[model samples]
Target: MPETGYMAAAVAVCTAITWALRALPFAVLSRLRQSPLAAYLDTAMPAGIMVILAAYTLRGADWGAASSAGPTALALAVTVGVHLWLRNAVVSILAGTAACIALTALAP
Candidate 1:
């Protein structure tokens, strides 16, 4: 059986370790905020992520069939157009998603 003091000390050590782990990322990120690489990533990551998402979304489409591919193509177009017109990622994504749902529902 552990003593009460030993148990208290163990709990304190665990709490400190947990706090440090949670805080480490913010500490490192605060330091990295001034780095050129972080700046570049801040600018580049959105476009890169959008491209990757677009590719992933369309990769499984059956290009030879209009019925299968039409909704996806229209959704992508709407997404791009909305993003370009509104310059808002959230609105673009929502509009594209709504377009896709409507198109799919209307499809036979």
Candidate 2:
């Protein structure tokens, strides 16, 4: 385990890098508003975000294991049902989490 001070410094460094990666483009583009690069970035950002989200979501997926199927399917069903019924973020999230926990606990 990392020492407390080392962990804090590592977290601070990671946070700084993340912030700089996100902010640098905007800062540069603001100064070059009329550039083609700016227009390209604006149009490409949504697609980039979608690809990143898809990659993140599928990163840990293990299709070879049947163990993940039941709980994941149940949680997905719960999430869809809750969103359809409540249309509220907090309620949907809580309901989904609760349903997942209950289903996981009951699973063989």
Candidate 3:
């Protein structure tokens, strides 16, 4: 195990690195507001986020198995359906979670 002082220093360094990485892009963009790269990045960021979310949603899915709840696929499907039908995130999420719980309880 690391010494307390060493662990604290490590944590501080990690925090500083994380903060710098998160802020680096916005800081550079602010200084280069008129750059083509900045404009492209601004529009492409959402697409990148969507891709990350998609990967995360399916990260634990068992594609080989016919059915599995390892990745919460049914919940995701219900949430998306509710969002499309009702256009409400809160309601959809609540309903989806309830549905998942209920279905799980009733599953054989």
Candidate 4:
């Protein structure tokens, strides 16, 4: 068994290493806060993510079909309109999703 002083020293060193690992990100993040790349991503990522999501969601739709096309197009319109009107993501997504589901279900 190790001596008590040796055990305590080992524990202290481990605790310091763990603390430094945990603190590393916060230190890096403070540096990132002033970075130009971070600044651009802050503004661009939201719109880019939205576009990627929209594309992924719509890509599987059978848009050439008359029945599927109308509901899909109208759903997109409703989504854009609601987002423009309310400026709310949850309500807009819900309204758009509801419109798409209801319209597709009601379609012949």
The residue-by-residue lDDT of candidate 3 on 20-92, one tens digit each, is 9898878666877788987888798998998798776566444543335732667778878999999997999
Note the residue pairs that clash in candidate 2.
none
lDDT of 4 by residue, 10-98 (tens): 99999999999898889668778889998999898999998898877677564543447788889889999999999999999899889
Ranking 3 against 4 by TM-score, winner: 3
Least lDDT summed over 10 consecutive residues: which range in candidate 1? 59-68
Show where candidate 3 strays beyond 4 Å: 1-15, 60-67
Q: What TM-score against the true fold does each predicted structure earn?
A: 0.48, 0.65, 0.60, 0.55
Candidate 4 residue pairs in backbone clash: none
Per-residue CA lDDT of model 1 for 1-108, tens digit only, reads 999999999999999999999998896698888999999999989999978986875774555334457787898899999999999999999999899888988988
Taking every candidate in turn, the Cα RMSD to the unseen true structure, in Å, is 11.5, 4.5, 5.2, 13.7
The clash count of every prediction, one per candidate, is 0, 0, 0, 0
Report the Cα lDDT for residue 95, model 4: 94
Superposition TM-score, candidate 4 onto the true structure: 0.55
- Cα displacement (Å) at residue 81, model 1: 0.7
| Index of the highest-TM-score prediction | 2
Model 3 weakest 10-residue run by lDDT: 62-71
- lDDT for model 3, please: 0.77
